[model samples]
Target: MSYVLCLHRWVGRQALYERYGLEPGMQIRAICTAESAQSLPEDRLASISTLESLDDATAVIAEAQRLIELHGVPHRVVALNEGDLLNAAAIRERWGVPGDPCAWIERFRDKLTMLEVAARQAAIAILPAVSAEDPQAVQRLLAEHGYPLVLKPRCGTASRGVRILRQAQDLRLLQAPHAEPMMVQAFCAAPILHVDGWWDGERIVVLTASRYVNSCADFGPDSALGSIELDADEHERAIAEQVAALLAVFAGQREIVFHLELFDDGQTLRFLEIGARVGGAEIPFLWREVRDIDLVGIAWELQTEACSRQRDHARTRSRDGRPLHGERGAWVIGRRESPLRTELGTLYWAQEALPAGVPSGVYEGARTRLRLRSFDRPALVRDVERIFEHLAQTWSASA
Candidate 1:
């Protein structure tokens, strides 16, 4: 039998075990944080090991060694959490497992490195970015990119510690300083669109583009934000091609799940950043519910190489054999103060809520979240505008 070791600090454990548990000739062993141990399925308890913290690579390696002693060496080691990707890469390197190396993964984790790779290798346009610690470098970036800059943690997640320097006064926040490394980028006033899908070593197997109704900078604790799936139009197709090229430059030969964010500046698309794992927020849910595909499950399959299924499984067609990528599908996330009540009414609360995975709770400290989906393009657009209008009204009222 082949042994597979799965590591997860906060997310994707249940789904990982549920999918890998029943596969023939595979014995799945999961190592997760102590707090998440209880949440692991009771039936799958025997194969799970709880640790104080997965952030410690030593503890994880020790656990992996124990698993190796009991069973044979694991053929594959996996982690679903974005933060754990590096730790997982370290373990894979130690175990001589088949996966992307640490250096390759770092290109995606580090903001500065990602920009360099995108600009140099992929020939993609990126905003001027620099380390926030150096005073001279900061000034250079300001001089080149001008004001209205964006500052974020070099390795931040979920929009935490992200700030917008709209005016000269905002630069004061940078003066006080912090120990953690940060990056400053030129702020673009373009609508943000995210592309989520799988990238085989050679091609983009499946891809979907979503336009964010509200920019991340505008999102707040109670902000109403959503993304609508777009038809695979010419613009979307070009974006996908660009993303595939960038991934080819980053991963080389590794197959991985990719969530890429870009700025659609009317005339052209500019690079934002990319995540090697599945997209956060309602992206995975949208893939499963709206498109009838288990994106996370497919990612797991790619990691373990346990399944021989082709990417064709995720391809879609209408009753008349027309490609369905042009069809309408969307997901909207709203808070209690959102227009879902005033506009969507009962239809808003009718939809089911997805489990808050890993970095639980909403990004930007949202208190409550309501998610809804629709296949009607016009209806999706109308409802999205209503949500955005409600957000604008709420912001103005607070101001």
Candidate 2:
């Protein structure tokens, strides 16, 4: 019997059972932090085994090893935890499963190292960016890059600490050694787009490429979203090629499912950064919705490549699934000043009834998904405005 033990379940992976056909029998265990374990549904409640600390490599891996001994080493072990990628990579290697190279994963996560490696690759077009602790180095970047540069953590997801510095004061305040290491970039004037997919040791299986609409200077915080069509224009094609080439260099001798970001001017597309694992909640969920393919499932199959041919066939069948007409999008509702709640209300609205005739009302709470028909733009604006008015601003920090 084949088993897949997931290291964490918060990244929409609980849907794995329904979406990927993993029944209780196929899943040996779900290992996650105790707090995260609480978030699982009752049905998922059965197979979970909580770990005290996912941050401690020795303890987490040892717990995982113990689980493997009791439940038997799974056919695959994967991590959704950003901090646990290295651990997952090592565990996959020890268990003799196909996984991304630890060294390459490191390069992918470390923004400084990623830029350095991509600079050597002829195909990639990563902007010249720098991460520094020195005050003078920070000042030099401000002068060289000029105003309206981006400041973000070297290793971050979802545009968490990302910001645009428009002044010398902003640079000085952000440059200090406060918490996470920060990367400063010459803010390129371009529309941001996300391209997500897997690398089968050779080629990048381009999944879904979509445009991102940011509410503020950075892509993070409260932002509305829209889906753009997939077109491999010369600039976009070059961007993908550049990303593929950089993945090969960073990966060296392993396979990976990379979630990459790009900056596209109408004329050219530039590489932003790459995440070594699956992207956040919406992309993976929405991509499968659009393509009828499961990236996580492919990742698992990639781990057991003896059936590479079969897996490849499955991928072709899944990837060939027709794209949906119109578009689907995800949006986050938060204010620049407010204590944003985490729960996304309820999923009671129908997709066909949005953006046009929907009533405007504030559903107070966390972020909620409201589906809209292509022709429902007016209704969407009205409803969103109603919701916006009821929301009062409060000082708080959130993603």
Which model scores highest in TM-score? 1
The Cα local distance difference test for each model comes to 0.69, 0.57
Query: Whole-model lDDT, candidate 1?
Result: 0.69
Q: Which of the numbered candidates is closest to the native, going by highest lDDT? A: 1
| lDDT digits (tens) for residues 1-399 of candidate 1 | 676787865532225356442356566678986656645555543488888777667888888889888877778887766767888788789778997678877877888888888876544577888887776888888888788899898877666688989887888877766656888889888998988877767777777878888765566655656778776567666776677777788666777778888898767778888889887666776666566666677677777777734244664422121225454455555444433347562133323343343334343124334445655666778866776676667767776
lDDT minimum window of 10 residues, candidate 2: 357-366
Q: What is the C-alpha RMSD of each candidate to the true structure, in Å?
A: 4.2, 7.5
TM-score, every prediction = 0.82, 0.69
Error of 2 at 110 (Å): 1.0
Instruction: Give residue 304's lDDT in candidate 1 (0 to 100).
Output: 76
* lDDT over C-alpha atoms for residue 80 of model 2: 55
TM-score of 2: 0.69
